[model samples]
Target: MIVVERTFTVTATPGAVLGYLQDFANAQEWDPSARRTSRVGSGPIAPGAHWRHIRKMWGVTTELTYTLIAAEPDRLIFHGRSESATCTDLVVLHPVPGGTEVTYRMELELHGLAQLATPLLRGEFEKLATGGVTAVTAALDDLSRPAGLRRRLGAATPNRLPTPAEETGI
Candidate 1:
């Protein structure tokens, strides 16, 4: 098993941050590893809502089905399962002086034959997860930046946004 977590402050209200984070599909907008994420079963945002993600890591792509296991005003928990692995993601939000403090924690465990390969794959898993979370941090930072200051961040990343075909394919 591998566990990684990060905490960051965003210049958005706790309500705003909660709303944004509640939608798992938003991962496509922020997480590099998530090639695509879409709601699989949805009526309202609550426990039991499901999302599907086509995630790419270490040059290979696989699908994971994630279900919200817990939801509250300030916290959320999701359980994701693929054929070879299961991951749990916990997100906690709190109001701060200026904005919101976001804490994200993820735990990944290998199962079946994949367990035997964990040693060989741990480095890549760590790298991929770190990069994805970093992307999420950068995205939230960009959104929170004052509009006038954002342009100074330089050119937009082209490939970061998937093309129409990629979106549909995933």
Candidate 2:
């Protein structure tokens, strides 16, 4: 079993962060490892929703079925399963002065013969987890900006707008 937890702050409200993350299919937008992610059966996004996520790592592609295990205004928990491993992802959001603070935790449990390689794979997993969190923060910060600012910043990375206090010098 390997676990990676990271915390970052974004220029968006807790509600905005949660709304963007609640839909697991959106992983493709922020996760560099994700080849594709899609909702298995779509209606409302809530507990019990499912997503099919395909990710490529170290030149090997793997597919996992992820289920939404818990949902709240400020937190979300998901469980994923594949042939060789099981994964749990937990995301928590907190209100902050400028925006929101996000804590993301991921746990991976390898089965069968793969468990033996856990030590060797720990470093790689840590790298991926750090990169994933950075990407998520970038995506959310970009999405929080207005269209005009986003366009000027760049199509790839939108600019984050200043808060009302900053604008009024309050």
Candidate 3:
């Protein structure tokens, strides 16, 4: 098994961060690996709620289904399964002195041929995980900026208002 975790501090409140993270549809706006997300269950997300997402990896596309196993106002835990692997993602939001601390962690288990290539695969996973963390950090930074600055600076804008999508390069 391999695990990767990253955290970022954002000016947004925990509530705000949780609100954005809880919206499965918004995954495209922040998670670069996600091509699209579709809800599979009715009503608001909670334990037992399910969703499907198509992700791109290694120039190939794969679809996975995730079931929410646990959920709190500021934390979410889910497991995802695909033909080759299974993984758990934990998202946590904590209130801090100035804002919120958002953390994302993933634990993965590879099977069959994937397990045979664990060493090489782990390196790739690390690169992907690091890239993901960087993207999340960028997204949060953008979301926390001022709107006026974003509009005024346009493409050249430095740290002005940034949409989660723009920040994460999703």
Candidate 4:
């Protein structure tokens, strides 16, 4: 078994932060470890909502299915399993002085051959999880910043802006 946890202080309110985080489709936007994520069921996120994700780790691609185990306005817990392993992930949001305190934790169990490689794999997994947290934190920060400031700072610039068509010369 391996576990990793990270906490970040984000400028957004807990409700706002959780709203974005709970959107399964947004995982790829904030979670650096996720190559892609898609909702598997219809409707909003709630208990029993399922998501499938492809994540890259150690230069290998892996797929997992995550089922929402618990969902509250301020907290969410999910369990994910692949054919080869199982893991639980918990995310908590707490109101803070300036913003919100977001904590993410993951616990994983390796089976079969994976178990044999656990000793070598644990450290890397921990590092990967930590990086994911950092990426989320940074993304939240960017999201919380004022739009004007974000534009001026050239951070997280959007992909397209309307441009006037060039006049044709006769």
Q: Indicate which candidate wins on TM-score.
A: 2
Model 4 weakest lDDT span, ten residues long: 157-166
Off by over 4 Å in 3: 141-170
The TM-scores of all predictions, comma-separated, are 0.78, 0.85, 0.76, 0.80
Q: What tens-digit string does per-residue lDDT give for candidate 2 at 34-72?
A: 877778765898999988788898888988889999999
* Stretches of model 1 off by over 4 angstroms after superposition: 142-170
Query: What clash count goes with each model?
Result: 0, 0, 0, 0
lDDT of 1: 0.77
Better of 1 and 2 by TM-score: 2
User: Candidate 4 regions off by >4 Å?
Assistant: 146-170
Which window of ten consecutive residues has the lowest lDDT sum in model 2? 151-160
How do the residues 1-170 of candidate 1 rate in per-residue lDDT, one tens digit apiece? 97878788877777767776787877787676777677874388788988877888777798888898998889989999999999999999989998888999989898998789788777776676677666666666666767777633223433233444777996
What TM-score does candidate 2 get on C-alpha atoms? 0.85
The model with the greater TM-score, 1 or 4, is 4
lDDT of each: 0.77, 0.83, 0.72, 0.76
Give the poorly placed runs of model 2, Cα more than 4 Å off. Answer: 151-170
**Pairs in clash, predicted candidate 4:** none
lDDT, candidate 4, 46-156, per-residue tens: 789888777887787988888989889889888989977898988999999989999888899987887887788788877776767677777677667787765222134
Clashing pairs in 1: none
lDDT of 3 at 98: 83
